[model samples]
Target: MDRPQIPLNALRAFESAARHLSLTRAAVELCVTQAAISHQIKSLEERLGVNLFRRVPRGLVLTDEGAALVPVLTTAFDRMSDTLDRFMDGRFHETLHVGVVGTFAVGWLMPRLRAFEALHPSVDLRIYTNNNRVDLAGEGLDLAIRFGDGSWRATVAERLFSAPMSPLCRPEVAHVLASPQHLEGQALLRSYRADEWPRWFEAAQAPCPPLRGPMFDTSLALAEMAAAGHGVALLPVRLFATYLENGRLARPFEAEVETGSYWLTRLHSREPSPAMRAFREWLVDAARAADERPDLLRENALSATDQSL
Candidate 1:
């Protein structure tokens, strides 16, 4: 048995006519005569055994069936057009869509994207940034880079690197902190993860302070708050290297706590596309190279003057 074939020409004609509500306009758009458009639509209706349009005094109106069919055809045609447009220099550039956590995207990935592009000229990379939270399948993403313990349900994860959190604050705030114990008295900004501040304090061998301040979902905003003297934010120091370099923020303590690490993840059921596989290979290799950096410092300690990381 064979599935009934859908006429591509009829779909195009019906979609155009439904959009403009005029056969004459559809003919102008398709560069065909009005009679040809009408004949195609009549044949389509006969094949489907449904009245697609309701002809009225002024113009045409779509029946319920036509309304249902038009959107599907329109989307299909637009996607086909977009794919055709990707052909360049006798090469068809493949598109790979990915989602990323805002912190990693801004602090790490942005700097290295140029190198990835240089390595894979035929792979077009598209990134959608989130606040360490995303639905990969729902968002139609090929992969997502996020900070976590690599335990997201229904996801297959590959570890990128550990990005531990430590206390970061403005210069004036840093001037007061003589020891991790002293942080007990300062304003502490926090994440939704209530354990981060307490866990960080525990790592420093200091009593956990009564944490207080505005909580943020993204480290980008948290870093900004700390830089502006609002509070000390527990953040991944390596990710915010520019802040330390530009004197916008400083690590007040050598103590750090591991909440999670950056991981490259994709849905367990999704088979890797060619472009996705290329990106993953390039990304993993790049991360491995960064891991070998002498100035990467330890996860529990960091150097402020190690040539700005």
Candidate 2:
């Protein structure tokens, strides 16, 4: 038998209600009355000859048939959305989607993006920021900059740079910090990862006390907190170089730890496009130049046209 004619409204109602598992919530989202949504769902179930939902005392629950249908609908909708996104620019430029860790973006990537645009004027670069943890394939990113040991499966990884952690705070706070032992008294800001403080303390040859302070999700936020004099933060020395140079922040002590490095990664299944290849070359060259510049140790000229990122 051929597929029965399904009303778009009824399918939409079912999709919304099935997503929320509540006709009332779905109705609110769709801007229709709850009763209308219920009617549409009922009509859909009747036409399809399947119970889509079970009306429980508290809320609606999806039936087995409804559960099985969700993934198919979700995929279809996502594909449609992706197609619409493709047509958004209305130009012939190739789209390059990239995901970068927040620290790398603010400290390293943002400064040098103009160079990428200047060098590859035709490539439409779309940048997304995440907190280091990213799925290269699932998120549809052509490339991602992540901090790790370079061992993600099914992806090719290239080392960008090693990031070392150290205690950073405002200059006023630094005046009182003669040695690492003095850090025990100051408010210690923390990151989502618990090991940063411990690692910095060990590197400093100071006692790693029980760290208790406001935990930030990203290192950039933690660095900002430190800049505000909220507390001292164990952060990547390279990332916060701008603040350190400009006196917005300072290193309280000289101890540092080489924790991990940033890696440029992409899915193994994808062959690098022209845009990607250009980016890879520029990125490798920039990283190499950074390594050769000894002035980068004292005052990282992060504001330069090519060196900003």
Candidate 3:
């Protein structure tokens, strides 16, 4: 069976009109006169022998048939636009859309990204930052870097680095926290994760502080709040190194608790590309180098001294 021919101009006019529900606005978008837009729509309707839109006094409204077609047309147009955009570069390149946790991007990956760019100059990288919670397939993300227990069901996880939580506060507030137990009386800034504070306390063998402060979506936010003297935040020492090094924020004690390790994760069904493989290799090597740093008194690997931290 042969399909009927579709008028490109008429379809464009109808799609625009359907989107804005106004011929005038559609004309503005199409860069044509309103009369031209109306004529194209009418021509489309006459050719199809069906009413695509109902013109009310104020604006146009899509009929049931038009309403059903809008999404399909919109999706097709969007995909076409995206595909065409890649061809405009005149090179065969793959786009890797990666979603990274905010804390990791700021604390670790942002500084080291130049190395990856140097290696894979042809691969286009689009990074979306989220707060640990990510949708791999729904967001069309190739990879997600997050701190977790490696329990995500549909993803393959590769361990990157461990984040340890400890009491971090402004230097002025550090005096109030003489011991791990003293944290109980101070204002305890919290994360969205309910168990973080309690788990940290358990690891340090200290009493849990009364949870009373702003709950931050990211450790970076919590660290900033702590640096501003709002309250004490249980932060990943590795992530908040800049503040610690610059004396903006200070660790009250040496009590470090293993919160979770950062992981490079992707959908189990996602096939690996050369660019992805290179990135993974580079990331793993970086993680290993950080772990093997021969510096404690010599240099602060866990503190803000290491760029990867």
Candidate 4:
């Protein structure tokens, strides 16, 4: 059996008429006369040998054949429209999907995203946030910004920068801590990585206490908990600069321990697209600029102290 030769215009007319259930409204949308819309639909019905619609007194009702055909036509038209929308300024828009850790997404990347958008208007960048843990291939991600030592298996990881872990808490909590030893009595908030608090204690030359506080997967949540005076949380102080600057959280006893660095990672099996390359370059440049700004970091770390004094 041969496929029926149907005109695109007739199919469009039938689809519009079916959606509106009125030839007059469909004609208005299509910028054609009611008579022309009726003629196109009639021609489509004859080509398929089907009674697509039943003309009623109020408007129109679809038959069983029309009901089945509507979905097919709607899907086809939607896909066509989406494809056509990608073409802008005589070039096709390239899509780049990135998965970033929640901490980095909110604290670091959110501030600079507008810069990325301004630099690359042709790239459709989509970002998804997760905890530090992510599956690049499993989640169908083109790239992932993760916080850890660049040692994941089957991945090409580029070190962005290291954010040292430090103790951040509310002003009232910091006021009581003249020395690191005072933290032993306070509730110590913990991350899924159990060794962070212990490592931080070692850096401060204080005895490590048995941690029993609430554990969180994301640093963003842990930082919020600390800011709310739940307990002292060990976090990346540089990343949480906004909170520090605003006096919501304060870093006490400036003893920061380096546990891991953030990395830009992608599956080794996957090839990088042009959009991905552009994003990678921009991110690297941004990270470098941030690293060169030690004065900014110092200002944020000291802002809470200045406010309290």
Candidate with top lDDT is: 4
Each candidate: how many clashes? Answer: 0, 4, 1, 0
Model 3, global lDDT: 0.81
What order do you get sorting by TM-score, best first?
1, 4, 3, 2
Give the per-residue lDDT digits (tens) of candidate 4, residues 118-179: 99998999999999778898899999999888999999999999998889999888888899
Residues 1-309, candidate 1, lDDT per residue (tens digit)?
666576899989999999999999999999999999999999989988899999999999889998999899899999999999889888889999999999999999999999989988888889999997799999999999988889999999999998878898887788788889888778888888999988987889888878766789999999998889888889988789888877787776777888988999999999999898999999999888887872555432345523223
Say which candidate scores most in TM-score: 1
lDDT of 3 at 98: 85
Off by over 4 Å in 4: 1-80, 89-91
Model 2 TM-score relative to the real fold: 0.67
Q: What is the number of residue pairs that collide in model 1?
A: 0
Residue 163 of model 3 has an lDDT of 77
Whole-model lDDT, model 2: 0.82
Of 3 and 4, the candidate ahead on TM-score is 4
Can you give the TM-score per candidate against the true fold? 0.86, 0.67, 0.70, 0.75
Local distance difference test values of all predictions, in order: 0.87, 0.82, 0.81, 0.91
User: What range of 10 consecutive residues in model 1 has the weakest lDDT sum?
Assistant: 300-309
Error of 1 at 33 (Å): 3.2
Model 1 TM-score on a 0 to 1 scale: 0.86
Model 4 error, position 237 (Å): 0.5
How big is the positional error of residue 46 in model 2, measured in Å on the Cα after superposition?
34
Off by over 4 Å in 1: 1-11, 39-54, 61-72, 294-309
Residue by residue across 1-309, what tens digits does model 3's lDDT show?
Answer: 565677888888888989999998999999999999999989988877789998788888889988987888788888877867766357656688889999899988888899888877767888899999999999988888988898899899999878777788877778666678887777889888899889888888877857875687888888888888888888877776667778787776666778689999999999988768877888899888876752452246234323222
